[model samples]
Target: MTIMPNNPPIFSTRKIDLFVPEREELASVLQNGLRYHFVEATVEWVDCPDLTQEPFNLATSGLCGDAVISEISGMSYLFPFMESEFQYSIKRIIKEIYNNFNNGLIIGASICLRLQQQYLVQLGELIMNASFSRITEDDIEIINKSHLAFLDETTGRCALESITNSDPHCYPHGNFFISEGKPGQVLKVRAKKRIGLQFLTALQYSLEKKYSSGIYPKLIGLGGTFVMKSGRARHHIMPYNWDNNLTNARSIHNWLHYCDLDAPLVAVGTLLSSNLVYKDACKFSDLEVCGLTETHFHTFSSNGAAGGHFYTDLESMDPVEYLGYFYPARIFNHVDPRPSCNELIDFTDVMRLATI
Candidate 1:
């Protein structure tokens, strides 16, 4: 996936396991380049907004009454916020069985948008890997005031921070030690004798070896909770949010191209927030609070789509699932605006597939 201004690149990362498929589709889409207009012709997916917690009362629009289940991909779902208006016309329900290739894990899917035949295009590189959201006042404070600190890699303990006030405990970890850096005065992440000095050496060495040819210091953080902003005379922290740009729709889709989502692929086009964490398609515009503004936070809206390693791990025995993340998109690839009348396997009755 290619990254552009105002859009963050979403990437799924996994432990270095060469056995897994190599990451091929690294960069894909941009923000301004995106155009979305919902049409009933978009009848494929809609979690009818009729639930109690909903801010808008959509029931009056003749969209309420009766909770229903949508059976797809050999599974069932019921979003109370939704109603019977959009039921999958049970074309034909038959008893069918197959092997649980993913060991009961929820499978995820990569969305194929009908817009512009987008999936057919070539993958591009991300020009910038930083969040393009309007940097907030709070974000500036976190960057300028040294609110973030790195942990001791070994003990994993303030581990270290840029000396802000007259904290005699920690020495100034910078190049010029001036209030702000000059044009080319780049500040390096340094640890005091008391801090994780050993860790500092290892971290710098590791980053140098891994990233190779880069003179700039890296800003590291886990989600939106913690941040470590590297200071450079010419550098200023704009704004970065994990939910906003951790991964994009194409990153995970590209990565999952070869791998089988099986059951754990429960939400790819939430492709994911790890273990080759994929950010799913159509997830861009549907979040309540996307960690950028006060409205919503997260990439996939699936609890930020980073549900930890359990749902991401390939061999994870207990993979979890979360429905209702995608608004206009359905868990089932084909929504069949007209419920099926033909003979189809009944996903709800798992026992039917059982041995006699």
Candidate 2:
């Protein structure tokens, strides 16, 4: 593998068009106004004038989720959600994508059972080593309490105040339309490597590990696309957090410069709509980004209905026996059926049989 840089790569000019047939008005507001605040990036938001010109084909298609990935410079980025109901129409598109990937089409996507924009962004940040900063226990608690409200309070005018009070060069903005969950959504952490938990815990863990190892991890203040990357992670976990709020970690870096190392230690956050965009971005740049995925090949929930079956069926043995089940569930799990004898593997049996 190539030694990719661990910093956020700079983006060159790329043409992006907004496709919002479902929420055209919202799309217009976001495309015309919101894009300007996020980056020094050039973009265009066009009204779907074809809606009136074309017949509306209302079909009850079974759609998992959808993602559009772009590849450049050997890295991939998941495209941002186009703010449309294309979710219902992406299955056919994904098949084309799958075929394209096989045929060397640099950009492609997969139709997950329940993929979302937030998940895409989280995955993208990991793929791209964007800037990030650590959060404190207090910060974590506050974020857990009222994240969306925190987002609302900090976006635009609130962000301006935050940047002024913290750093002159830093200004954050909130894209309200990209909001993920309802305010009442309960935010809690299970065994899964949640983005909220990762952003909160990874930095914490890095600090703890650093200190214990007699090395202080440096604190880096990530804003703009950087912090937005963390937000991507936040949305990826789909934690039942009440609100989405952009927090500042630059303060921590400025205040505590000694408790760190030469390697930049930062906590980053961003509000992204999908990993597909991030994946595509990776293709155009070279960066080392890390996000969370299952380590255990056949990991399953330890508390869900499937979890019970996982242990019982294996007679309390290894996890990879029915690993494909885990992947599908990770995408989205409404129903899970055990594999047939034909699907079971001999190597799987050996692990369990040896343990027995």
Candidate 3:
């Protein structure tokens, strides 16, 4: 593998005339004020830097329920595992992730199905009855009380068993899980209802208060994008709503960082979005980019799967020209249903062919 250079080119953008047809008013409002960049370069993975190294521990945090479902889908495609077998596999993966992270805390959040029916009442009940306190080995009663009925009996048992064996202290709020571990020093698993950064901030504050020390927590959002700005700014890029916010050089810097990782940990769902854009004249001069194709781009944009608007800021480094972005085609295992356009391929094949 060729080592990426320390200094890479900056990504640049240009104006494009693409807009969501249904939300034309909204798109017009966005297009009128913003300069859109139509990314023309093929996004390849070789040109980016590798971030899966020391001092940069990556962890996946998002909706565990969705994760569980995705796992089931993936497994079902590859193996002939029955319900019971699948449950066992799920438990094994959960345990494997917990152990892989060195017995660190794992946190998650979700709204209760029962509570969803009675929004006001449930909200009040949750506020009054919920306890956000840290759980320890002795806090069995509290853990059981706070547990929500989101998971099946088998899955819940598996998750609880994994936590109990690894960390001993845990707090389950609705669909969220917060296990006990050292602040920033140890690997931590955190999940919430789309407010992961906010939760992390709160957890940091709590840790500081409890331990009275500095903590540098390494976090990665699963099924989502976590971008670190040029300075100290941090933002979460969701799958939709790209045009709702202003994305400048700092934002692009963070996005490129995700693709630059050694393994390109950015989720496949995010890459499919139209929000990620570049200009026709922009040059990916420095970084090696990966993923997607002209056909995939057309499908994503025409099918309304992609949202958001892109704009150019001369002050920020142009990613296409400097850092470059990677948007590899989605990969599927042997069992995954093939896309009509044949866009999906195995990463191993990509690596072998691309010589990464």
Over the stretch 85-104, how does candidate 3's per-residue lDDT look in tens digits?
21111122223322222232
Off by over 4 Å in 3: 1-48, 54-56, 59-269, 274-356
lDDT of 2 by residue, 1-356 (tens): 12122221222212122221223332233223322222222222222121111111101111011211221221011111111122221112212222222111111111111223546211111111111112432111111100110111222110000111111110000100111111111111111112122222232232233222233222111011111111111111111121222112222112211110111111112112222232333344543331111110111121111100000121222211110000000011001111112222111222233223
Expressed as tens digits, the lDDT of each residue in 212-303 for candidate 1 is 22342221111011011111100011111112221322322222112112221111111111111011111333321111000011111111
By TM-score, the best candidate is 3
Which ten-residue region of model 2 has the weakest summed lDDT? 325-334
lDDT of 1 at 297: 12
Candidate 2 yields a Cα-based lDDT of 0.17
Worst ten-residue run, lDDT, model 3? 293-302
Ranking by TM-score: 3, 2, 1
Q: What is the C-alpha RMSD of each candidate to the true structure, in Å?
A: 27.8, 24.3, 21.9
What would the TM-score be for candidate 1 when compared with the true structure? 0.15
TM-score of each: 0.15, 0.17, 0.19
Every candidate's lDDT: 0.16, 0.17, 0.19
**lDDT of candidate 1 vs native?**
0.16
Instruction: Decide which is better by lDDT, 1 or 2.
Output: 2
